[model samples]
Target: MKKIIAFAGSNSSKSINYELVKYTVSLVDDFDIQLLNMANMPFPLFSEDDERKYGYKNSLVELKEDFDEADGVILSVNEHNGNPSAYFKNLIDWISRLERKFLEDKYVFLMGTSAGKRGALGAISVTENMLPRFGAKVENVFSLPEFNMNFSAKTNTITNSNMEKEHRKQLDDFLGKLIKK
Candidate 1:
């Protein structure tokens, strides 16, 4: 079976982005899905000085192994000030140092969500542009806006009919690309 890694780019214990990622992955079928929480793989704040001091940390190696093993990735990013959360950015910085092309040609289904109307579109756009530079084959991008209004935690469903239709279409497209040889 193909392996897919799903993660949220936030350290929040009650991350809405994490909830969004879980809901998105539930729409996929017939794959080995590994849900990784950034909070669980805590790393020191990345810096050139830290890199020089530590060389490479064991956490970076483990993260790389997971990325390398996965056939695809599903990522839901949390937006903070119209940018990726610090935790997510730090992970990217360290991972890039370890392997610049870690996501090389890996099918990536990118997503973001927020309580506001823009739906973390800024972060989503940035990731859509940046992931490809890291060799990610970004298949599709979706941003859920007004997340509190559109999604129901109780039912694990998108409440707005139109939004649900749009999300389903994007998910189907992403799944198609993921299974293609």
Candidate 2:
């Protein structure tokens, strides 16, 4: 079975982006899905001094291995004042140090969500553009706006019919690529 890694680029335990990742991957079948939480994989803020002093951690090697082995990625990023969260940015910085193209040849289904109406669009736009620089080809993008009104934690799915339709459509397209020759 093909393997895909799903993660939300947020440090919060109760991230809306994480909820979106779960909802998106729940609809997929017959594939190996590794759901990761950045909160569980915490690292200190990236700094050149730290890298020079400590070298690379063994954990970083294992993390790189995960990226190398995956066929695709499911990433939902959090917005912090119209920018990617510091935790995610720091993670990327560390990962990039291991290899410039750590995500090379991987197809990514990118998403973001927020409590307000903009739906983390600003963060998504920047991430979508920057990910390619690290060699992730973003195949699809979704932004779930007004998380309180649109998603239900009890149901573990998108509550809004129109948004759910679009979300599923995008998810299906990304899944097709993984299952396709």
Candidate 3:
């Protein structure tokens, strides 16, 4: 079976982006999905001085291996002050130090969500543009706005009909691309 890695970029234990990514992964069929929580894999704030002093951590090496082995990736980023969350950015920084092209040639399904109307658009857009430079073939992108109102935790469903339709369409397209590959 093809392997897909799904993760939310936030370190929040109750991250809405994490919930959104999990829900999206449930929509996919057949693929072996590995769900990762950034919160579970704790790392210190990344810094050049730290890298030079401590070298790479074992966890970072393992994370790069995960990216290398997976056939595809599903990443839903959380935004903070119009940027990717610090925790997520730190992971990226550490991962890049280990392997600059870690995501190279991997099919990436990028997504973001927020409790507000903008839906973490700034962060999502930044990732969409940047991933391609790292050689990731981003298959599709989706943003869920007003997440609390649209998504129901109890039902694990998008309550808003129009948003649900749009989400399904994007997911279907992503699945189609993965199937083709």
Per-residue lDDT for 134 in model 2?
92
Pairs with backbone N, CA or C atoms under 3 Å apart (clashes), candidate 2: none
lDDT per prediction?
A: 0.89, 0.91, 0.89
> Candidate 3, clashing residue pairs?
none
Sort by lDDT, top down from the best: 2, 3, 1
Against the true structure, candidate 2 has what lDDT? 0.91
How well does candidate 2 match the true structure, expressed as C-alpha RMSD? 0.9
Location of the lowest summed lDDT over 10 successive residues in candidate 3: 172-181
lDDT of 2 by residue, 1-181 (tens): 9999999999898898998898888988998999987778888889999999998888777888999999999999999999999998988999999999999989899999999999999999999999999999897999999999999999998999999999988888888888882
lDDT of 1 by residue, 1-181 (tens): 8899999999888888999899988888899999987778788888899899878888789889999999899999999999988888888999999999999989888899999999999888888888887899987888899999999999998899998888889888887887884
**TM-score against native, each model:** 0.96, 0.97, 0.96
lDDT for model 3, on a 0 to 1 scale?
Answer: 0.89
* Top lDDT prediction, candidate number: 2
TM-score for candidate 3, residues paired by index: 0.96
User: Which regions of candidate 1 deviate over 4 angstroms?
Assistant: none
The residue-by-residue lDDT of candidate 3 on 73-126, one tens digit each, is 999999999999888888888898888899888888899999999999999988
| lDDT for 77 (candidate 2) | 93
